[model samples]
Target: MCKKGNEVDKDLHSLQLKNFMGLLVPHQRQIHAFILYLVVNRADADDILQETLVEMWNKFNEYKDGTNFVAWGLTIAKFKVLQFIQKSKNYRFHFDPQLLELLEHEAIRKNGVHTHNERVEILKECVSKLQTKEKVMLDLRYEKNLTFEGISRQFGVSVPAIYKALGRTHARLAQCIKLTLEQRGVA
Candidate 1:
């Protein structure tokens, strides 16, 4: 009876880890966006993501099967984000945590409506409007996953110049998305 109980416990733990891992990786992009929306800093968001992953793994045994994993993960993420905010009080930022929850809810809702193919169609049109130079920068940055420094070396331009060019390109693309959505009455 003791040996059977030990095997059952190990099997349950294994099943919990398997379940947690299955949900963790694919939802990472959405999770990171939620973190970013709350923290408003990419570097800080990345740190929180790592911490969130660890927390999720540590608490795998506590997570019940058949519940919404995204919600559970977001609850953990929200706590970490609030902690980061509380610790950075000296930074003089005044965002309300309640608003962060609203943002998270909105983001998840929006994510469901905006399909990848729809974004890709809008992106193609936006990319077409970009200047020849900006198009190359976008291609190198995304299609090739090249770093700004690599792009700078390739173009014989300074890294800051590459950064600004890519930044402006991104802003332009965002504007295009906004305008496109408004035209479709989707925004």
Candidate 2:
């Protein structure tokens, strides 16, 4: 019950999946080692490896036939490692200054693209110095992407209070990032 083009597409999909699996199976160990190097912990590296493989499987359809499979797979693995580091409980970001500079350069090289890694680190340091409630409020707003209404509902606080808290947090974070960047001669 399929047209000719549909049958051809189905066959192509099957071939792509098979090829991707073939590539991944052979490179699994290398992939794991690369992820481990980035994460620097055995358990976290294992979790990231599993997540990366699952993501690659789910996104296999997006891979172009006859393209560089290893590069694409490594890209997915890198993204998973970054996400794991960002969300980990005992998170300690240890990126070198040169790597940070490279990332910043890449962000600027991309048209209309933006990243806040340096600013986020400075904000994290400053927020760690904040009172618990203020830190929690800021995290809920920015990190969690919760709207004022949603945060208000969750915390049973007034929307205005949430707004005020966020405003104050934003001001403090801005000042902190400015100071940090200035101290590092990067601003």
Candidate 3:
């Protein structure tokens, strides 16, 4: 009974992760851009974006369906930006705190986030550029929702091998997407 309960909990967590990723990926670039705008440093923006994503995932149960994912994410991102700013004594802001607050409120009110169809197209192209094995790995893990252990068993490899391969593939795709976005003057 304990084993069965553990299995059920694992399955539930997996489902929640899948659902969260489905909602998160499409808005990821937008959230990053917002962070960049607030922080004014690519490295700082990246760190804040990571923090914001973790917070969003942690509080995902509070998110409502059929609502504004970008707006919700931006609220979290704004808080993260402020938190980071407060923490970093060396960081300097071009605008005052009042202006920053106004910008955040106005952005939310205007719903300035735009859908990145071009990003989707670029991502598809990038995925197509991957090697056959890499493509299959991504499909199995993401599209087929296979865990690392499951993928390893299917591919006759160790779980760490599968994990490393997926990590490398993810990094490659992220670089590809970012480069493509820059080339298109979208980033």
Candidate 4:
């Protein structure tokens, strides 16, 4: 009986490891690329990717077997992206229209098999030019998708303050985006 119990435990451990390795091994690059595309910076993407992987590992039990692994992993990645965006001070500065376009393209490509690598590259250039505060505000409003009330709660300010911040941030971002687009000959 003791021997049988030991064998069962060993087998379960092996199976769990195998499941984890299997999920991570094949999807790691894709997941990283998706994260990079969202965050538009190599370092931030790397951090978020690590966080996503850790989250996936911790929540592995919640994943249903024999399901779409990429989708599951991407879902986890999305959550991590949102978390990173919320916490990151640099996110506001890095919000590029090109990045936004690339993310949108990626969503469509997932269903139809296209690529937005060039768009992502362009986005990186655009994001690099934003003012620090503008970048942070953009990250808070758009990337994190925080509502005025939600943002107000975060800073313990009034909802109107959040709205004013967003308005000012948007104005700056819009100007930057327009200049970027014009320079790129897209406008």
Clashes of each: 0, 0, 0, 3
After superposition, candidate 4 runs with Cα above 4 Å error:
1-10, 96-187
Candidate 3 clashes between residue pairs 3 or more apart in a chain or in different chains = none
lDDT of 2 by residue, 74-171 (tens): 78988887777567647565465467446534433421222245555777788787788887887787699898999999999899988887888778
lDDT of 1 by residue, 46-148 (tens): 9999999899899877888789787788889988888888887887664686887788788777767675467779989988988898888878988998988
Score every model by TM-score: 0.70, 0.43, 0.56, 0.51
Output the lDDT of residue 108, model 1: 73
Predictions in order: lDDT: 0.83, 0.74, 0.83, 0.73
The lDDT-based order of candidates, best leading, equals 3, 1, 2, 4
Residue-level lDDT tens digits of model 4 in 15-130: 99898998778667778877777777888889999999889888888898899877888889878877777777564655555675579466536534422453445466656776
C-alpha displacement of 49 in model 2, angstroms? Answer: 0.5
Clashing pairs in 2: none
Tens-place lDDT digits, model 3, residues 19-86: 98998887788788778767678888899999999999999989998898888999899999888888
What TM value does model 1 have?
0.70
Q: How big is the positional error of residue 83 in model 4, measured in Å on the Cα after superposition?
A: 0.4
Worst 10 residues of 4 by lDDT: 111-120
